[model samples]
Target: MLSILIPTYNYVCVKLVTDLQQQAERLECPYEILVADDASEDAFKRENRKINGIPNCKYIELQENVGRSRIRNILGRLARYDFFLFLDCDGGIVNADFLARYKALLDKADVICGSILHPSKQPSPDVSLRYTYEKHAEHKFTAQKRMQHPYAMFRSFNFLISRSAFQACPFDETIRNYGYEDVMMGLALGRANVSVLHIDNPLMNEDIEKNAVFLHKTEESLRTLYVHRQKLGYCTGVLRLYGILQRMHLIFSILLLYRLLRRVIRRNLLGKRPSLGLFAFYKIGYYCNLAKERK
Candidate 1:
């Protein structure tokens, strides 16, 4: 038996339900879908009731917004099966055989990870650009490298793990929020000597609108970095190099801002609008902050 666990917030419940329905239809074996919602203030509870009629789907809404790590940990503990598949509410099945593929290799590895891909088009330019960049980064890994690479810590969008492994090392709720919980979990699994198998299956990640409250999210990322730096002693040389790159990226960003303004004034650009590439700046800033915390 397999338990498909999803963590949801706010209005994303609609897509979450739809994706689960698709997964249920496509899966060849029996599975239960569990949605652990973080007490969205929006109409998700009402919406969830309307969709409760869907088969093999269970929804649990909390009284408040507990962070993702805690929510997932709760789901893991509550899951009925010995094996669990963790899927982001926004992720959907790419092929009919995705569940079967994971099932085939369950005995050999403690964790099996699937690849994440983006849809062909997106509703918003900002969202489209972000998806395009992330898709590029995710696909850069080969199956072997993805399975064993040290950098695999950077990804956690799609994966499967045995309930026993999860029981041995549940997500670090101390990390809180969204950033490094996945990395910490992967590291814990490594320490336990659990084999991580990367499946070469493409999974679709639906693009969503970027939140206007971006700075708040960045702060969460920075907090996560601080915790990671404390837990894992990253090398000093790498730390110094990270600071230098961060400053360089910030300088280049100011220059790029001016260039972007000039182009916008010259003519109306069609197709996808260019992003300021602030994600790189955020990453560099995170590394720099981590380095500072270490000092």
Candidate 2:
């Protein structure tokens, strides 16, 4: 009745697959798990191939990397069932009743986004930035808070979407980058008048990136947001700032400030306990700089 679709890259999914398989088995429902590797390296590919040995699961590796959006669209096509549960390969199943909870909501929510949590305890210094940001910002609320800004709260990492609803509003493949495709999905759903339902069925985000690596990806995502401003018409604080800069034609001045603080910003963000407020400034400044460079 449900197809669990995961798109992976350079990550082993055996543990995640095993845990999810056990949960699906307990549900005793017709469900299948599909893991699509986006041309990961040979070592990681070999390790992830073990998912095929698990019951109700299959591993398919692509010859070339199709970025994030296309790969997910491909996985959705491979699904045989009506409901598609799109999950990241790095997600850890904390709730044993995860699949059951989603199954219960099938009659009601057409597009439901489950929650994601980092480890309750502290992680290493290298990976602190992601966990800290998630805990402080993303993990703070539930359906009550999210229903207010349904489009803004929508995330692609762990969500259940019907095939019909998904085909109506698929990820924008033109955004050939790492982040905000989910935000774009949210925007599409909003246009379709699909409210993103939130639930307590949470997934543990176990695999955390190094502080430097996470910061780099954050920069990339911000740059993407700048490039696709027309598509992402929503008003984020950063986007508003960008818009204001464009109106004033003051990108060059902001670029100068960003260049002055770039090194200082890097040092702060790359440290063990980076300030998220500073990180916000860092991203805004970086996006301004990137916007200028492109011009």
Candidate 3:
């Protein structure tokens, strides 16, 4: 039996659950759906309640909000089956034969990841551009690759793993925020000599709006990336060099920073305000570090 684990936040979309229901009903093999909700204020819990009678569907509601990585870890521990298929609440199985495909690959891989595609939207060009970038980034790893380069196979949206792999190596809870948790988890699996398989099956993403909350999450993600690098003892030389290039080219830096500031403002006004001034300061520091490295 396969245990399908889904971690949800403040999402109102009922289609995610409905799609899973359809997939579960049609699957020839035995499978269970576990929905771990992170205390959403909206009617997400109530909406989920409607699906309680569905066969093999279990819903869990937390009293408080825990970050996505931690919630998934909790679900991993509670999973009753040896194999686990983790899906984001906004993601759905595009291929009806998804479970079968995973079963075929489980013996050879500790981890199996699928592709994620974007939905069409006409109004928001910025949002569309971001989604396009994300889609291309996630689709880049649809083949077998070395485990040492775990970042190449990382995507939190859709993937399958053996419970044993997680039992031996679990997600880093210190990656308490949203962004780099997937990368850190992948790296951990890689360090443990776990093999990852990337399948061609596409997971369709539901429509998601770009808002303040999403932007805040992005900033948190970058911060988490910084933390991950620190833990891994990876040098920030490349990042520092990029920052130096920005400083040496004033006009280009202004334009680049303007674009970044605009996107940051649009997506994360609620979070710490990222000012052009502070960004310039960061660039100066980055350049100084690069110069020190040269000496």
Give per-residue lDDT, candidate 3, residue 247: 72
Model 2, stretches more than 4 Å misplaced? 245-253
Model 1 lDDT, residue 244, Cα? 62
lDDT of 1: 0.67
Tens digits of lDDT, candidate 3, 26-109:
766678888888998756788876556667788888998888788999999889989888988887567777667777777878
lDDT of 1 by residue, 1-295 (tens): 7898888776555655666567667766678888887887656677765555778888888888879789999999889988888888777667776777887887978788877777766657645445545656655665766755733343467788898888987888886666767777777787887777877776677744453234346456666666566564452323345546566665355335534553442222222543434444444544454444566
Ranked by TM-score, the better of candidates 1 and 3 is 1
Ten-residue region with minimum lDDT total, candidate 2: 137-146
Deviation of model 2 at 198, angstroms: 1.0
Q: Model 2 over residues 226-278: C-alpha lDDT tens digits?
A: 87987887456688887888899887787888889889878888888788988
* Clash tally, candidates in order: 0, 0, 1
Clash pairs detected, candidate 3: 179-221
In terms of TM-score, how similar is model 3 to the real structure?
A: 0.76
The window of 10 residues in a row where model 3 has the poorest summed lDDT is 267-276
lDDT of 2: 0.87
Q: Which has the higher lDDT value, candidate number 1 or candidate number 2?
A: 2
Candidate 2 lDDT score at position 148: 83
